[model samples]
Target: MKNLCYTLLLLSSISSFAQNDSILNFQDETIYRINILLPGLEIEKDVYKDFSVVGNLGLFPGYYKNNNLFSNSEEGFFFIPFIDLQVRYYTNFNRRIEKGKTIVKNTGNFVALKFTNYFGTATDHRSTESVRIAGMAYDIQRTYWDHWHLNFESGLMANFRC
Candidate 1:
């Protein structure tokens, strides 16, 4: 009886160290997105306490409008390959936590500097030149029903042809 008591006491006294992360100030994860406007893979990694860097490789599908007198206006599916990167600063982590909101999956308001490179535009007549665009934007991200991610962003982008 004494030995069993001693063993139980020793086991109870042993320390177990683990991360309790009950309250999160920021998000750290790699997200695979295919059902959004930009379908691709992206990862958001922490660069500072509230700052993170994200990279994406995806396909851009849109319309091509031509305004030339010699040629007719043809509206066809234009699919282009692109790569994008962003430096994001999450601005509402503490506020969301205070409001009893779940901060899982990086859902919050953020300001980001975004950069993207287009390999080429796909159209009836293809262009061999590439384009680069850089911009800064305010973004809002949210998850609905735990799986659907909705995002909205608005900003000015400058394009450079190369």
Candidate 2:
């Protein structure tokens, strides 16, 4: 009876060791990833001279570059070509719009109006050209703690090309 009990104990120990050894010898594999997507953006300043704003106002004028397009080379190589442009903006504001709820309480509000224009061609061969005029006007009224809010907005949008 003693020999039988000892034999059972040894078998159980050997089985446990074998299970642990199998786990230790397991090899981890690496995953390979390929990305074929391309996106780009560029901004240039054409005019940045100081301009007077009767009320609280900020003015920015510059060039805009958008290269969000990818061009495929003849050799199956993918490349991104950048498009250049002139952009101008004029705006006036009553005050700085507060963003998000305030730490102290719910009281926060914001209003803004801006006009933007874009001029340039994105294609290297000048196959396409575009001119755009756009405007945005927004107003938001929020509670003292800013968790809830009401908003009113309207604007003009246009695009012209030749």
Top lDDT prediction, candidate number: 1
True-structure lDDT of candidate 1: 0.77
Per-residue alpha-carbon lDDT of model 2 for 1-162, expressed as tens digits? 999999999999998754233222212322121212323332222133211111111122333344434763322222333332222232221121222222111112323334333333343432233344444443333332223323344545555443
TM-score, candidate number 2: 0.23
With candidate 1 superimposed using the best TM-score fit, by how many Å does residue 24's alpha carbon deviate from the native? 4.5
Q: Give residue 102's lDDT in candidate 1 (0 to 100).
A: 69
* RMSD per model, one decimal: 8.0, 22.0
Q: What TM-score would every model get versus the actual structure?
A: 0.71, 0.23
- Please give, for residues 54-150, the per-residue lDDT of candidate 1 as tens digits: 8888877766566788887665566678898999988998888777776777788999999999886534465545789999999999977767888
Name the best candidate (by TM-score).
1
Q: What's model 1's lDDT at 113?
A: 96
